[model samples]
Target: MSGATTPGLPRLGDLAWAPALDHPELLAPTVAEALRAWAGRDDRVRDLVAVTEIDPDHADTATLNDMHGLPPEASANCVVVAGRRGDVEQVAACVVTAATFADVNTRVRKLLDARKASFLPMDRATAESGMEYGGITPVGLPAGWRVLVDSRFAAPDVLALMGSGVRRSKLLMPGELLCAMPGVEVVEGLGVAR
Candidate 1:
C-alpha cells in the first residue's frame, strides 16, 4: 500500500497520502466506520479525503505540519470542551485551523449557554470519546456532542489535515466535507487568529 493512490487520495503536493483503508492501524474503529459511511454516501467525499501515516511522536498539529512541509493553515485541530449549567453537562468538539485558537471561554460558553466551560480532562476525554487524547477528530464523536467548525473551513476545495483518532496517522480532506457532517455547526470567528 506504500505507493498506491486511490480515488480517495487527493493530490497534495509533496504529501504521501494513501487511502484511509490502507492505514487502518492508524484509525480508531469509530473513525474508520465514519470514513466508510461518508465514502458510501457521497462520491465527492470519497474522492476528496485521504490518509497518511506519521511518527506518533510528531502527531501534534504544529510539529506534524512543520515536519511534513504542510502549511500551518492546512491543518485543523480538534479540542474537546465540557460545560455545565445547573445539573446539566454538555460536551462539544471544536475544530480550528492550526494558525488560530478556539474561542472557548466566551463564544463557546455562550453557545452552550452554560455557566462554566473548560477543556475536558485528558483522561475523561479519551475515555468518553474512545480516541487517543492527541488524535481526537470530530468525525466519529458520540451522538449529541455538538461539533463546532470554524467558518474558515467553508471555502471550496480547501483541505484540512486532521487527526484519525490515533496519533500515528492523519486524515486529509476538503474542509467543506467536514462542514457537511451531521450536527456540525459552522460559526464565524469560532476560531480566533492567534
Candidate 2:
C-alpha cells in the first residue's frame, strides 16, 4: 500500500495498512480471535478493518499522534475503570477522543452506581482483559465488562483510530463500527474536555 492514507490514517504520515485478519502478529491473541469472530459474523467488518505497524514506544496517544503529526482528535483512547457497590464488582472500558478524558469521577461513577471510580491497575487490567497494558481496547473486552463509548463518535464517516490490542500496531475503522461493536453503550457525557 503506497502511502496509504485511508480515512482513519494520518494525513501527514505514510502508513502501510493491511487487513487486520491478514496480520495476526499485529494483534494480541484474544484480539485476533475477536476480530476473526466479528468478521465471520459480519462480512462488512472483515472488509473494512485495517491495521498498521508502529514503533511500540509511540503507543500512547500523545506520542503516537505527535509522531504522525496527527491532530489530537484524530484518535480514540480507551481505559479500564473499576468500581463497586455492595457485593457486586463493576468494571468498564471507557472510550473517548484523544482531545478529552473519560468522566470517571462524575458521569461514570454515577453510571456505575459506585461511590467512587478509578482506573484499574495496569497489571490487573491487562491480565483480565487479555490485552497489553498500554493497548487496552473496547473491541474485545470480556463479555461481562461494560463498554462505554463517547457519543461524539455518532458521525459514521469519522474514523476511529485505536490500539490493536498490542503496542506495536494500531487499528483503524469507522467510528460507527466501533460504537456498534458487541456490548457497547454510547454515552453523551462519557467524555470531558481535557
| Best-fitting candidate, scored by TM-score | 1
Local distance difference test, per candidate?
0.84, 0.82
- Please write out the lDDT profile of model 2 over residues 1-194, one tens digit for every residue: 33444454323245677777878888988889988988887876776788888999989888888788766674879989997887777999999999999999999999899987999999999999999977888778888889999988767577778888898988887788888787889999788998
TM-score of model 2 vs. true structure: 0.91
Local accuracy of candidate 1 as per-residue lDDT tens digits, 4-73: 7675466554668887755677789889887777768777666676788778999987787777688877
lDDT of 1: 0.84
- The regions of model 1 sitting more than 4 angstroms off are none
User: After superposition, which runs of candidate 2 have C-alpha atoms over 4 Å from their true positions?
Assistant: 1-13
Which residue pairs in model 1 clash with each other? none
